[model samples]
Target: MGYSPTHFKSINPYNEEIVCEVPMHTKEEARQIVQNSQEAYINEWINTNYEQRAKLLNAVAKEMKDNLDYYALPMTEEMGKPINEARGEVNKAAWAAEHYASFAEEYLKTEYIESDATESYVQYLPLGVTLGVLPWNAPFWLAFRYLAPALMSGNTCIMKHDSHTPLCALRIVEAFTKVGFPTNVVQNLMVGHSLLEDVIRHEYVMGVSLTGSSKAGAAVGAIAGSEIKPVVLELGGSDPAIILADTQDLEKAADVVVLSRYINAGQSCIAAKRIIVEEPIYEKFIDLLKERFEKLKLGDPKDESTTIGPIARRELVEEMHEQVDKSVAAGARLVLGGQRLDDMQGFFFPVTILADVEPGMVVSCQETFGPIASIIKVKDEEEAIKIANATDYGLGGSVWTGDVEKGKKLASRIVTGQVSINGIVKSDPRLPSGGVKKSGLGKELGPHGIKMFVNTQQVWVGPVKS
Candidate 1:
């Protein structure tokens, strides 16, 4: 009936210091939590009116704003995100909450159908409890992205956050509680990874949403599938940034590409992993990128002046280094930083840039989740599009060109979920975000996201005259 004393420590990636030790919930505790959530969904949340749901969502947003620094600081400490970027993530989460609150009514409105019956319509109804398996990167934003939409659509959620960021997970639950959500409407289950399948298979859980690696997605997808439960996956992406020869300003293009490739030390799933440039401007683009990489200051993430921070974990640093080493061995030229910073105390990897990258190289072909940029040269727009589509992951991509129409046209040809023209690829509350192929299975954000876990029921009445 109670949780065990087992616990896990949240280690600061910058200094390897223990930020906090959190108790892990036992299997029974987790099961009870899920049951409580289900009961709350069936008894209270389902009957809660849309107006009241919108108000609660807005209150959560206000709570996030009121305690922005409190939430942002722990995120940076638990994950290696730069403090400034962490702050931005907090703001983004608040915006998502508010965005859903403002538009849920319109998005979930009933649709009337013309038929022989006297009255017929389709209604969007909640599907009870949803399980969200969240990742550590952008901890707050990723969790809130799904939480806001699910709650606004009248479904309760039980989140199983990454083990490495327990503090961040607890903080989110606290925020919900502060907003005066009904008891058990939103809860956090701090359990080990092995218990995830049990939670997924629980009878009361109707849906599951995950934001993590491709491998994790596959495993969870299989589990959710076996039970005939609906799932939404936002997985890994080796997204490409294509630069055409027709670009008017090379400087602007280079700036956008650099930020997209290296933000959050390049741990993002949608970060520009592959940089495909037209042959005419390849050399110029590489030089500009190199200059930008050199300008980045790798230091403590807590420092506001630091632009680049350490990879989140020690094993990730080794993995990223291995990728760089193997790529160089396979003939990819390292133009800038390619080695880990030995002098630093934590897992600090420098801003690395690789040129002459080819298809078979690890850097070009795989999802390199670090501060490393792979530059692939192509002959023309045809080759650019060809190379961009040559990956298994198709989450997101971007096109850089002077002509907006040309960029949009090229974006249409890219095989991905979403694409941006002359701008960094990012998820917006106004549009649906997710991937095609192996990147992800379902969409998130926008109206589609709020409806992902809802059931569409049809209502009909016969005519009085026979």
Candidate 2:
């Protein structure tokens, strides 16, 4: 039959305006992704040697780096993510390709082992075609996170990206092909989420990975579980940035909070949504934060001077506005920067700080994926950890203390899958990225992430000569 991607709009979150109307793939068309990837996997890609796969991955990373500005510009235009943020995602996203390029060989190699009876061996095998239902906020990074690892493990990828980010999903497929990946190694489905459950139920889809909300993750988990197939989920986070009274540099702590929350206009799952400061330094922290927020230029992403820009979508801006309103209704006070910039033509919610934020407050428990942080004062590290761990999320957290031992100790106690001491941390290809509790199951990015889709095989012999 005939097929065409459905129409979808991406609004400039800065000024509440339409940025673009993208064509989305229909369910019928979406089915092609899995079919094509499956064909590629079993036909040609599966047989490609590890050296060739690594070479292709490295070429893709190089292609991405070479065209960083081209990708970043479009990302900023479509998603309203600040220019630098999009560029950094490009750089960081390339790490996956680089990582797989250098490491996939050793990772997939068969290893010698010994059993009591005789000789033994261990080898890794790849799963078949995998479906990745991706998110928009960090489109390039998330899409490739699955691509790099899955391909490294010998599994071809079929991706159904967020409708709001169809261009990003398509562009990534282009990147793969440009880097010399054979046809269908990574296929982008321009379809709607309506087709997700049906596609995951497809026999060709051996595994799946999703990065989105908790509710969404649960739904995917249920489907994948029922199918008895594997899935990796990296869900939501209201990560906390804990500040100690004895922190050596209060200004640096404030700066860290500002940068962490405002990146991508705070549309990150691991963004520091909560700022828990010890009471002794709370007032000073607030003052410095206000000063820094004022200095942050909020305007056009292409402008070299703009540090913050419109959010990704208008609905997100409205939602963020409602959150601040509900927080006020619930007795939270704004220390500085709340509400939308009315004159701007994009979806722009000003960087906001809600003080006296309590657990049930709108800005407290909720994962406000905007430039908003709920600030709470704590008497000591115990309360800081308590407040930090109070949420259903366990994605990421940070501890600020001059004492290295105390910082490390506090990080150990926090429930998050990743934490940083004295600085804000993003997921590195070197460190596995996943979460505990409600955040997600399984992992992505590092060696463990790459191996998640791999099958371990053991072979045994009757006896040994020795």
Candidate 3:
């Protein structure tokens, strides 16, 4: 491959070896892609009926399922997610594609309004090319979450995936092409962050959907807003897992809490970052969590036995360590595994746990995107709720309790995009997921997701006189 100054080199987080390099598209090439997507939207995609779109979407899903093993490799290599978890991410993406394909028609059906003079109704119409700015963590799942819904709504897309995972990003575009999507229908632009503003402000691009840091969101949102274009942002999250006083299943709760926190090495936006346990069961939960943390094996992501893997990059590992250090200095007790594994070749950090974690500490207030569990002791359910909602983020939170009704009540009180009762907060194809406050702007998934880039046009008939 030809090397350019703008080419992105993918590095394996497991071994710190160079995987491959992908050349960045020039400004002219990026403009052409956007224009081509707009043409596709106007000429063919928008005119196609829901049945035709659904057929193609389902075909894409089938292709993904057939090549699950093939696709999971790149994801695991580039991002250090466990091989099994990478495969699971592919499966979830395929499921999302099929889910949107099966339900888009019903979700977008015209709504009839009764009137005295004449008939009136509302119909969902397709917008033009949408710009998807996706992140590297769970690369396939995050892109598909927006791609499936955007395509199902008859809108074409131009994706600007994370710079670190160019190979995985290209494979995503290839999947659509392999499934018989026309050229430019779902294009991936291998470009740098400098070009993001130009793409978002392009005349042909109608909307923007992003999943990234709050800083990135603010930059993109500003451009989209200036152009009077709609933008959906899924930004940073410091999610909390509340363990109530009456939670009877401490073992089960501990298991879920550990899995939710350390899965994807805690890089996920919705990972359980803060563990808030009531005073009565606080010590019990902490002991159980400590045991669970001790059992995690940090090694090669490709190893099926490895529960914790390296962070996606060295910079992230450094940042996580800094947070841990500052939090420790601020009086958070380092219960276990607070040091980085300097002997390891790759970006491996220990499954660290900080006890007596309280407000004002770095781990408690900031979004730490690594396998560091910060446990906070709460006086009661009210304090748990208060602590959970203390952060500026309101992405996803959960309540653990044996009483389902009580859990639901507490979940409702927490100000977040989505909450779980007796379970972990996760993105589902059947449910709407997004956030409020600084967390994000709009929703994704469910019927609401498919409509994010569409226009709700009202059709009115002429009055008929008697």
lDDT of 1 by residue, 1-466 (tens): 0123477577888888888787888899999999999899988999998899989989988898888889999888988789899989999999999999999889989999988778889999999999999998889999989999999999999999888888899899999899899999999988876888999999999999999999999999999999999999999999999999899988998998889877898999999989999999999999999998899888899999988888888888888999999999999999999866888877888899999999789987789998889999999999999999998999999998889998888888999999999888999887899999999999999999988999999989887324
Candidate 3 residue lDDT tens string, 43-122: 88888888898898898888888988788888889989899899899999999999988999899999999765478899
Q: Which ten residues in a row have the lowest lDDT in candidate 3?
A: 1-10
How many residue pairs of model 2 clash at the backbone?
Answer: 15
Question: Candidates' TM-scores?
Answer: 0.97, 0.94, 0.97
**How big is the positional error of residue 40 in model 3, measured in Å on the Cα after superposition?**
1.2
Instruction: Provide the lDDT at 442 for model 2.
Output: 92
TM-score of 1: 0.97
Q: Sort the predicted structures by TM-score, highest score first.
A: 3, 1, 2
RMSD of each: 2.4, 2.7, 1.8
**lDDT (10s digit) by residue, model 2, range 328-420:** 898988888886687776667888888888877878888999888788888999999998999999999999998979999999999989999
Who is ahead in lDDT, 1 or 3? 1
TM-score of predicted structure 2: 0.94
Query: Which segments of candidate 2 are over 4 A away from where they belong?
Result: 1-5, 12-23, 464-466
Model 1 CA lDDT for position 433? 97
